[model samples]
Target chain A: MAKQFGLLARFKDTPDLFHAAEKVRDAGYRKWDTFAPLPIHGLPAAQGLGRSRVPVFTLIGGFCGFWIGLLMVWYMNLYDYPLLVGGMPFFSPIFPFPIAYELTILLAAFGTLIGMFVMNTLPQHYHPLFNSEQFLATSSDQFMIAIESSDPQFNTEATRLFLEEIGGTDIQVIEE
Target chain B: MATTTSNLPTCPAQAELLDQIRPAEHKETPLVGNKRDFPWVTEKICTIVESRVPTWWWVAFAMALFTASFTGVGLVWLVSTGVGVWGLANPVNWGWAIVNFVFWIGIGHAGTLISAILCLLKQGWRTSINRAAEAMTIFAVVCAGIFPLFHVGRVWFAWWLFPIPNSNAIWPQFRSPLEWDVFAVSTYGTVSALFWYMGMIPDLGTLRDRATLVLRRGMDETLTPLQRKVQTAIWTLRKYGYGIFAMGWRNAGNHWRNYEMAYLLLAGLSTPLVLSVHTIVSFDFAVSIIPGWHTTIFPPYFVAGAIFSGFGMVLTLMLPLRALYGFHDLITQRHIDNMCKICLGTGCIVGYAYIMEFFIAWYGANPFEEFAFINRAFGQYAWAYWIMFSCNVFVPQLFWFKAVRRNAAMVWIMSILINVGMWFERFVITVTSLANDFLPTSWGYYSPTIVDIFTFFGTFGLFSVLFLLFLKVLPIMPMGEVKFVMPQADPHGHGFGDTAQGANSEMKGGAH
Candidate 1:
């Protein structure tokens, strides 16, 4: 038989896809993924994806915004020009609080949006997962797991045995 | 393939149902008795609209409107005739005008806070009355604007507040508290208008669909053409308007994520305005060397008082509105519970401020400050002070009990009481303190003339007229948001999954 580049395994149910993907991962194959119409919990671990770092980015953005506001206040009222109103300090932190709060939030939001876009590697026109018609079920109602031949551990006989052991049904191999 | 095909059979059927085109013949008339058991929502909603305003609502609005318009018409006469027609004397420059200004502005706060703040927290109960509350905010702000504009006496020169370099080559004093007022109020109006419009767009589409030919024609003129106008409008909106604002929403895809971002942004934006607006308003009092006004606690105190009065007004508006509009489901006991909690919290803060003011007056050991507090409670104008205490402090205490908080009738009564109390609190601050300043010889009693009273009335009338118009025009609830918040619409744990994967995969991979 001709060598296939990818093995496709449809799930008995959504949960089966996750279990099969987990087995594939434990078998030490990295070039494997699980796809479903909706997000399946714990599938990220099954697919070797890590947790997000967007929150840290947001915190940094917020900090930057706070300092920027403080800097503006200092520039406008203290360094650039100074006016004494009611004998209060030129760079009063009390009045600067609202501006600082606003800027912090603004920066945090911008960071979140940008961070999300950058992390997701989005706006791409094409993906390998889009190649198979059977895989189109990933956008509708079915769950599917695909293990590419790119994996170091992916041998045709061994992968087929691994998928069948983990409750994968309607399995097939595909090539480019 | 050993997979059972039975479970998968339904998918194709659903897909066929989705793709099947309904004939236009049945479009104009929905099958009348298709689901005979489903209670008639159309009739119910119509009955709600035609129902008389609750007796209490009319009485309350009439009384409040009388007072509001009295103050309003009084200001008009002040402008038309002269400021001298009113009771503002020297040293006591800020009088009922300041009192009304603060009072109305304070009432405005609860509306936005209820709408935006509660929405952010996912307190779903806010949907029903948020429209009315937002409308109240706009109206109260308008009423608040009248006093300050006429306070200058030369009302026509209001344009000078703008940053217009004039023939006199004069620019507004950027440092002045009044100038800050100009900025705060205008910014607030613009932001509120945008928020309100954004909220109304989807509901407006819903209303457009259900409207009669005349109403449809009217809405179509502004929105789009009639016939298939609403369908076209909604489709376009769902495709484009929601395309951008929806933030990569696909169906209910990432609905909550987008809402969370937009809502967080709004809350983050408005929270500052809440603090800044009142702080700037307080500056008008503080910049003056009035011993009582020149206190550091003024900002927090004013903010607390604004929130206190604002929630009070919201309760006052909501109690009747739910009954009138048949919105009991949307504005539930839980919403009232939260609002009552706010009122209780803010009331305590105001009460604490009152105590702190007296303590500080004694601590400062300044006779002017001491006498101001003393005279406020025990002097000739002590009536206003007691009314403030009883209304602001004592009345809100009823909310401590779950029963009282949940009880609509009692909520209405307390809300009105709080409004009265807040108004009197402003009265005590503006009139009593200014009237009895450091110089005993310069001290004078300031009673509002009929013109002052009339201007106040006219303002209430104006507010009511505007409110009535709003009811007729806009959808009272945000329909799009309602669909978004429903349990069926929640796709992922946080509405961030495949939708996020497609649009934001690059960002999600970032190391930071």
Candidate 2:
């Protein structure tokens, strides 16, 4: 463990943690977060986070996939050594609809996956929160709120006191 | 009573009438076990993966391994000798290979239907069974994929199906239905695998965290050299492997927001696939000009049968599993009943399609089509046709009786019957139509060689081996999703109050 990273406080349940989030938000701290074992219905609004951008990525991916499917079919059948088999036209749009539709879905699904990881900045190998043994409870049944040292208003003493005042227990100073 | 309506019995009579007319409470059972807490859910599901293997598991695994090896041997013999080893010949070019391919692929459909379709509809009962079903989907597809690849005879040249650039400028036929099948099946496989893994991440984190706790507690204890090495390996792999797959999931608000969106998008994407994949597969037959194969109704009929067979396979696997592992609490009788209901509904649709096919054949006024239908019922393959009818159409009707659906043994037997009936359904469609076609001279009897029989049986072995391995290695149930549905998981509920105190008592309770 390195030097002091932040003050990590554990909450007994979601309501206590949710209330503490409101308090933290009202206090004007920017670099703090709350963790729970499952998604709390109102936690995002409580933390002031906005709508996710994954849908936008999916839209763009669908359009690209559609065009790619069209081009691949057209190029193979119409442009490259067109040996006509059936009496139908070489680049009939009607025939390619199935492949095009499938590609649209396939790429859109990939976009959602990639966009999520990029947006969340995931595959993060380590974090100071992992250093707090109590913080592991966030993945199971406990809720936690961590105020990082990087936050503008963070003070080792003042943050600890604020957390204690808000019904937060097992407050520990996490080390990097 | 009428004379004093205003004064005597107005209030009391109305209240009594309302009570009588009101529907009963319905008393729907819980999907999971009663009185289950957060830790209990996690412990119950994860313990299956962590505990010592039972004797039955060993016996089943050995049987699966033996069959899987037979599949390998079958494939080797297939590639070494040629497609000649099978009963495929003039006029009847397609045989057990195509039948098994369609059968396995149809079986794979239920998994996606359970996970994606039911999920989108907010069918809460799906939470208990979707994880295992999705795993089944992935494995069944693997078994399904082998047939087409080896059926091409020159297995080495199977890559010609794809549009990749090559030294030879010859491209695959753009309008071929076979080409469309390649894309549809491959995309289905990839998407299913991704969906299954994405769902497993949180549960994998639970396992990883649990293993970490055990490791830390045992650090001071003495151990034999072998035990020490084993523990060290498990610790290292669990830490790194799970760490990467979990993608730093801390259930933070932002993470949850993104995860939910991604999951929903994937489900939306997969829903269409559940319909489209089999529809395209049907095109491989319907687009042809053969008498029995050229019907306009193939797509919808195929989809219905796919779902029917898929549910049958789910029941066949889940019923035995629920009994063996004592997962009745999680996989309740209600779940079994619901699945049986789906099977029955789809089976009825399939039966109607059968009747419609015969009607259309006679109504169309084509001699070949009429003869094809007549031959199917009265010809040499009539036995297979009747088997398909009884097993698929008649057997599932038993589910109408609540007693039959609730009886695990009865359901198990019916599921096996449905599976056999479905396989015969495909066999009937493929063999009967092709065996007796336009010219009488081209008509021949199609009997599957021993190789064909072994190869089909081998795929079942492969499917079971993969499923059994999945059971031992991963959380067969989705603990994270299961927890979400439990009463205690509610943020505002008393469950959290108990959880809070429990957290205080054990500092690391959250980690568990």
Candidate 3:
């Protein structure tokens, strides 16, 4: 038999989900989360999460791309093999501006994707939550709150009762 | 859970009181119709992919595949023979190949404009159409790439355009406008693809779950054994296919937080990137000393024209799909009206550029420049020029009327004509200037061979084939994003406060 993973509770709709998350948060549980079909605007705040850390990665990638584009052009046109075209200078930022500018955007986009994947630790491809039939609805219509057994606050019976108290229906102790 | 009707003004006097306070103008057009909910939105979009192949899709796919074969034949012949197989000549060296390239690349811009620019501007309407539009951008870029790649004569030597350490000792010439185009087009394609895929992750998860749930819930007694077997096979394939790409998206709070931020950052990067693509494409001409192509207005003019043609292409693809899918509610009339307005605005800009170019030619008083402008409108290629003017400039003027804008059939026709006009636009610019250059002895009238004509037409077939496959497999709308904009998604909205059911639900998040 699969070991018990956590207690999963179903909320009726977005408002029910939102309020349940707030109650769960204030109740001092750490290893818990609310899942829904679409992003609720204030759910992150309710869940005690702050601003995402993706921008720093984007900034870093942009700077590197900008410099790399500029230097690559300089090396190719000026330093590596010098040539003159239409009596234009060996290189000017003006001519290579498009390349550098494009690279800035290109790498910045790459950074955002990378940062997101890293922050989310995605391509995980497996989690205990995947085992629950009810939890599958998170991407479609269902809204849910799951409290992991690993949390210090977890007690199967107590968590089930708490979830029910907070207007959660169909509470179940899902297993991995 | 049950705040369905009580939140509304139930009686006339109650409605009158509510209306007195509710600003009539404050009511934004609903993004979705029939007061849809999350599950319905997901089901509506997902079923398009999950449903058995429709008859029309089969018919369209057959035509697209048949048409795509011409491109395959043309390319094989071009490469096996030489560049001279086509109608490209000494004077008009850049002929239909360059014209088609610019036209297709111009069509690619609307996708990014809708996905990136509109997203940044908080235009909730973009959510319904952005998925298909982004797919169009990708397929259009693929078609755009084929021309320049084969136009180099030896398609094998195309790798030399990249700044890589190859057996060939030299690197790409960074100073060339063509080289700039390489980076610009490739970057735009990559970012647009990334944005499209990332945006679809949540929706892919939705499909994945549908496969799991539907498969688990056994079918009705109506299905035969063979039918059940086939359905099971498809569901299994879809489960793994979507599940793999979905990357185990849980719709968890932490995931959405980062996903949205990443999306915003990408949109920010793409806005400037989309503008830069056409601007750089314009530089390909403006940097050259050609009389017609040397104007400073080329960048802005080209961008506006690209947007006009892109919106035109969007309408061409969307009008049919929306009607076929019965997606009238999702793709509302407001979306069509908004797109028409954009076309009219940009068409005026393109027309102004056309007239302004002639004015500049007269103002500069250069005989060569003057001849180029005169030749475009009144010389050997006058027919092409007039076609461009009428289609791009004159036809789109119909959009100025609200009635015409609301009429999807009229708008669809205008959109196709806009596409045709823009194609001729590139033709007039590329051919007329080269056909009658400063030296008379080198001047020659350019016309495409059957190979050139077939290759260009084949691209449409290829685009349709790709898009058809996309429609058959992928969720065609950004279901997650669409739902995000619905009034019900707002936790602080009327449904969440001051109602009996809202109180029953204990909506504490609204307090935050």
lDDT per model vs. reference: 0.65, 0.84, 0.89
TM-score of 2: 0.91
lDDT over C-alpha atoms for residue B173 of model 1: 41
- Write the residue-wise lDDT of candidate 1 on B1-512 in tens digits: 12213543358778787668542332221111121111122233322332344565566566655656565556666778888887777867777888899989988887777677776676656665677788888889988988888888798988988755567655444456776677677666656665665455334322222322223334334544564566555444433432233232211112223333444555555666667788878878877778678888888899889989998888887777777766655566767887899999999999999999999999999988898889999998888899999999999999999989878899999999999999998888888778888789888888887776777757767787677656544455554444333222222212233222223333121111
Clashes of each: 39, 2, 0
Candidate 3: segments with Cα more than 4 A from true spot: B1-25, B218-227, B495-512
Q: For residues B174-240, write the lDDT of model 3, one tens digit per residue.
A: 8899999999999998999999999999888889888988888876569999988988888898889
Interface RMSD of each: 11.9, 8.1, 5.0
lDDT of 2 by residue, B306-367 (tens): 99999999999999899899888899888998999999999999999999999999999999
Clashing pairs in 3: none
Instruction: Flag regions of model 1 displaced more than 4 Å.
Output: A1-176, B1-76, B119-122, B208-260, B492-512
Decide which is better by DockQ, 1 or 3.
Answer: 3
* Pairs with backbone N, CA or C atoms under 3 Å apart (clashes), candidate 2: A137-B510, A137-B511
lDDT for each residue of candidate 2 in A1-176, tens digit (9 for 90 to 100): 57878888888765677778878988999988888777666667777777789888888888888889889899988898576877878888888888888888888888888878877778776777776667775665678898889898999999899999988889988888
